[model samples]
Target chain A: MTKITFKDAAGAARTVEAQDGSTVMETAIRNAVPGIEAECGGACACATCHVYVDDAWTEIVGKPSQMEEDMLDFAFEVRPSSRLSCQIKVAPNLDGLVVTTPAKQG
Target chain B: MTESIETDVAIIGAGPAGLFAVFELGLLDIKCHLIDILGKPGGQCSELYPEKPIYDIPGFPEVSAQGLVENLIKQIQPFNPVFHMGEMVERVESLGDAEHPKFRVTTDAGTEVTARCVLIAAGGGSFMPKKPPIPGIDAYEGRSVFYAVRKVEQFRGRRVTIVGGGDSALDWVLNLHPVAERITLIHRRDAFRAAPHSVNAMRELVAAGAMDFILGQVSGLKGEGGQLSALTLRKESGESVDIACDDMLPFFGLTMKLGPIADWGLNLHENLIPADTEKFETSTPGIFAIGDIITYPGKLKLILSGFHEGALAAQKIHRYVYPDKRLVFQYTTSSTSLQKKLGVG
Candidate 1:
């Protein structure tokens, strides 16, 4: 099990187990953490799973596709560091990954 | 004189369409920016469940909902796109014309972002589960009643009664049959609202004495010490009955709210933006809509359909951004170009 920390909209830190091959978004929703609503069901058709991926993981994280980028246009507070956590699966190297939820629950 | 970062395209909502956009646009070498309100991408699938198995999405055989997001995000990682989170788009600004409209994205926090293009992948809206308006309903959330269940393991050996009649309700009944000690399916009316096949299967199971069913309306709930105890029901004959159970599951329908975007007033009908179904463009120029949020000219709200619409919109955006690319390249890679540039090599 991989250890993943979720910083909810309230800045609450939640440590959860993310088994290998699981996305960070799954960890958050499974734990019932607030502010991480994946409204599109992982199809990347919705921007509800928006999160600020710690820039330090950029190498392990890589980048979003044109489709994901286009979907971000409809989100609330998109930033240079914003990433769809569902797009990123947890790897052994990402043991201590940190992700923050947007304050809004759209 | 300025080395400031400039964004070419900005996509909203990091669901399938958004993730695939990165794949499509990255092929064309068009850098873009991405944004979404949830802390993770994949919209409803990831937001709701990562462990829950899904059978509908194409190209997969019983894939976990979370599994799809991981693959999609990986597929689009080749293209580096910008990301924003915890932000709601307040408004979109224009640069006076469609050719060079400076897209100003304002957030609820008053932060502003500028991009050339914006894609609305916000999905079907924020879904709030609709429950039976029984007496003291809110008192049972997380105790006797639940808006959703992410873990089926929690209900092991527990007697669970599920309300409502839909795909989720029937599906949950089927999933929980082996896990729970006893399963009871409830609905408001005698006719089920779930898919015909699902309903048929459920009927078969109940008739064979595998599950229990009550054709009535929920009237009240009785619980103890933060744990669900029993359910009060009004039978179809107008008589009231009480059933003792360990848990109550209300598989009622979900209510989707478009959120603040609904206020934009894109000439909507029945909570959807009406547009040319093929174009996916909203009534207003420089502003488009897709996914379940759009309706017009015989349209069905489905995730795969949104993918097609989003691709079409991106191609249209590409054409709009490079209206003369065809004309410019008419003499570059075409037979005419070979004749003019290389003299028929």
Candidate 2:
């Protein structure tokens, strides 16, 4: 199991334990963390699952794919660390994976 | 890696146009597979206003959206189209050449579909439910709170507090009244945005003391582990009502945007795919678009227009899929081959 912390737009932190193969967005939706609308339900089509990986964990979470970047173009307040949570699959080593949701999803 | 399904044509939307396209294509011996975001095939007709009457459809003077979808489903029954319901087509890429182009379509659920051609009949994009902004409301989702009624038996003997002024909320209140131990409906105001028939029925139920109706907003939730024990409703008069309920259903309705379709590299005009009226093919050759998703000169986003487009698109698709074979246009009413395909012979 991989433990991850999702800091919502309001700065309220929600931590949840997810299986190794589950995406961070899946963990947020499973835990009912706000700010991650996930309207397309992790299709990477709707950028509602937009998230900004914590600076410390940016390298660990890696970068968004070209398709994810295209989807993120519609997201609000996209940052250099911004990534679609659905694209970030949870792994065991990333126990402290921390990401912040945008104030509003696109 | 994901499982893949291969087909002659992969229609994107399961709406009227897409469903009709199946019949049109199937008549020409082209098999199709469909994918829709909603759990069912009816699209907005069934999702938004299943009971609302639509008059513009040909032949039928007036028919409800759901009724039309049902009839279309029956019309295409002989086609035996496969539907990937509750899945959104996320990625679409072109393979092969322009003369014999094929598509690799993938949904959010990791379902891959390879097709000789693609039809974007995604009427007005995916229908996304509007969620209420009750603080910590997400905590109760999937367990105590729901936007769509996936099952009615889940609320059996449970206290259900439905929140909304629309038809969906009022409709559920009436439907679940008999099964639920207690039903409390809370809206921002006494006025409702639902149909008068539904509104009158709900008012009758409240007047008969069968259920409780309150004019208020859901202030917050009181629960743990996604299970709610009660809800805090703030009335217009600045009074709070601690409604004791096990489940809270919010039917705020839905808003449609060109979600995900924007990423497929198709040239979009005002969020609609620009297609030629003759073939309904978009800028991407072999990637045909119909229904409300396409925009052309003098184009009408009506079911009738989509039906016409689907017929024309099928003709063009036949030539694309079988370039060496000569194409012949035949009316279904007069053609024996078409009747045999429908099993009506």
Candidate 3:
């Protein structure tokens, strides 16, 4: 199990233990973490699961793929660290991965 | 005013479930008219991911989303189902009492369908444009900000700013270039998600200095009383630039909403209609719900499950459309009448 923390826009953080194969978006949804609405159910078709990776974890989390970058065009208030949380897979290497959900998702 | 259509059944969506329901209802000699908000037949299949592969469909190892929709369309072709595309069902009025249940369905495009039974196969409600999260942006909607371009004349002599990197943004940038005094295309990154040809054309315009292509996102909107004046663009380097514009068009894609379905007076279980397992009928008699928009014990939101629910719903619908006739369940494999209805006898 990998520990993942999801921070809301208001700075409230909720950490949950996620399965190795599951995604960060799935973990946030399973825990009912506020501000993360995965409307497309992890298909990466919609950009409703936009999140900002914590600066310290950027290198470990890596950048989004080309397809995910294309879908990010639909998200609001995108930044350099923006990622569609569904595309980020959880693993042992990402034991302490932290991401912040956007104020509003497209 | 156009005359209202009279049919034995009115299917509310053109997705896989509603299309299959046409075939099932057709086997029982019921004519149907399908109403969909999208201009095309396939709902999310065509809209969201048409090229994506679906593996769970029986008899086929793998089929594309659009391919499944095409096959379903072909399967129901013999029924000659009339389609009212690019229209949303605005109201569903129950015309008859409990004994003889009937409904008069109306759409936003002024199309009316009066049928003996109404089938709600609307998977995930209706697809609506996703609004940008810019604060106070709603105040400028329909006045100085627009999601769709119904009229090209509206942008004439105006400074227009088109945001997004998708087809809608690039297409409109090219289309409105001639009409608008100046066109500014804004995107977060330099890379575009639109067709290569459209991207090249936009780049050519930028090279010629005919239009402005900025690499940034719209952070705020400056407007008053539904009139947009300028938009604040924030660059990746934390630089904010205010571009003066009279109109702004953001081409963010679509999202699903449970619009108008909540107003139909049906019992909703967390935005989904609660239906019985046997007939797939809703709390209201003669009104059936199926597909992802329905909720029941052990209900799965799979395409195959929807097909099964539609088949059972047709059996119950036969009773409503043909009240005096006895329904005899038959299979197309051996029943000559069923084969004849399929046009394969």
The CA lDDT of each predicted structure is: 0.70, 0.85, 0.93
* Candidate 3: segments with Cα more than 4 A from true spot: B1-3
lDDT of 2: 0.85
TM-score of model number 3: 0.95
Please tell me which model should have the higher TM-score, number 1 or number 2: 2
Give the per-residue lDDT digits (tens) of candidate 1, residues B119-193: 676767644555555667777788768867879998999999987666778889888888999899877555554
- lDDT for position B60 in model 3: 86
Worst 10 residues of 2 chain B by lDDT: B186-195
TM-score to true structure, per model: 0.45, 0.58, 0.95
Please tell me which predicted candidate would have the highest TM-score against the true structure: 3
lDDT of 3 by residue, A1-106 (tens): 7999999999999889999989999988999998888887788899988999999999989999999999999999888899999999999999999899999988
Give model 1's TM-score for chain A to 2 decimal places.
Answer: 0.90
In model 1, what lDDT does residue B272 have?
Answer: 71
What is the i-RMS of every prediction?
Answer: 12.8, 11.4, 1.0
| DockQ ranking from best candidate downward | 3, 2, 1
Candidate 3 CAPRI classification by DockQ: medium
Which one is best on DockQ? 3
Off by over 4 Å in 1: A1-106, B1-5, B126-255, B327-345
lDDT of 2 by residue, B136-190 (tens): 9788888999988878999999999998766788889889998999899987556
Q: Which pairs clash in the backbone of model 2?
A: none
